[model samples]
Target: MTTETTETTGTEAADIQAIKEIVATVQRTQRAKDPEGFLALFHPDALWTTGHGKVLIGLDAIAEFTRAVLPAANWEGEVTYEPVHIQFLRPDVAAVKVRQVYRSAEEESEGAPLYVMTKRGDGKWLLHACQNTQVQAG
Candidate 1:
């Protein structure tokens, strides 16, 4: 393979790993109920639609909802968020599909969230828009 091809391949792998880390961080924040840390990953004009159909516009609204719910969430086992897929719409924009599993000793539930992320000029990836959908059990 050419040197340029190798470099591009390396970069793509790195980008995928970085995005995976971001998704994992999402789970960590949720499991720890760290609303502030979670909110830090969002863009200022980000929009989020919850699994239950609540539409939250902007970071402030998301912060409000997150701060209220995350800390008060009463779940037994830790939540898990996995990056199932990633698609780049542009060099600086991507759509990530994530699987969120909430596990407890006696109960388990799941959510499928689509995260649209944007890479800023500063090279930081921030969530631009997202939809959290409930995954029904069979």
Candidate 2:
């Protein structure tokens, strides 16, 4: 799906691009199993829900989870994150819908993740409240 934006101003466009980059970084970090890199994309008090429904609140909790799981994840795949939709809730806040796909030699899987991002004072967008949901085959 194409990205949906509420406004198309120059600033909004730039924000969209920045958000996309963040999503791209997520894909890179996941594929490389770089927990620190992945965690760096989040806000300090971010809230994250894993595809399996584990809830992680705050950066500390997320760090703990990432450290334990990422390096030990038993999988080999290429992961991609495509921004399907982006809605600007305010000048500094946005809701982004992503289409995530993981492809391995054996099979492929998908996920639909909604990320609520907030722009910091430095004009950097960071993931705030996010939910990762696995897409089941019908």
Candidate 3:
């Protein structure tokens, strides 16, 4: 699956911020139980590996999984995603490190995910490959 690409912003800082916001949208979409909205952040051929080690290749696969699980997820409280780091692999590619935090009255936990994004020819950053990992307290 391929679609038109989007070019990134002029400055690195601006690009980083934009990409971070895109990542945060994942948290927002999940919290709102909007699977399609969450899936919209990814590239058509993007790969996503779940925290549970399930590998979803391509947006279609990701969408299927998201539709099946995201809405049924019963986690209480707000889920948050914060970008901790951003590394540019190329002018149009980035590796973003994110911190995913889930906070509720009963418990608080975190997930560490690395999202590889690409600046499309149209100037938007989209997730290319992502790995979701649960952050275990040591």
lDDT of each: 0.84, 0.95, 0.87
TM-score of each: 0.90, 0.96, 0.90
**Higher TM-score: candidate 1 or 2?**
2
Residue pairs in collision within model 1: none
Top-TM-score candidate index = 2
What's the lDDT for residue 15 in model 3? 81
**Full candidate order by lDDT, most accurate first:** 2, 3, 1
Which regions of candidate 2 deviate over 4 angstroms?
A: none
User: Model 2 over residues 89-134: C-alpha lDDT tens digits?
Assistant: 9999999999999999999999999999999999999999999999
Q: Output the lDDT of residue 120, model 3.
A: 89
Local accuracy of candidate 3 as per-residue lDDT tens digits, 1-138: 111134545687678778868977887898899998998899999999999899999988999999999999988899988888778888789888888899999999999999999998988999999999999998
User: Candidate 3's C-alpha lDDT?
Assistant: 0.87
User: Where does candidate 3 have its weakest 10-residue lDDT segment?
Assistant: 1-10
Which consecutive 10 residues in model 2 have the weakest lDDT in total?
1-10
The collision pairs in model 2 are none
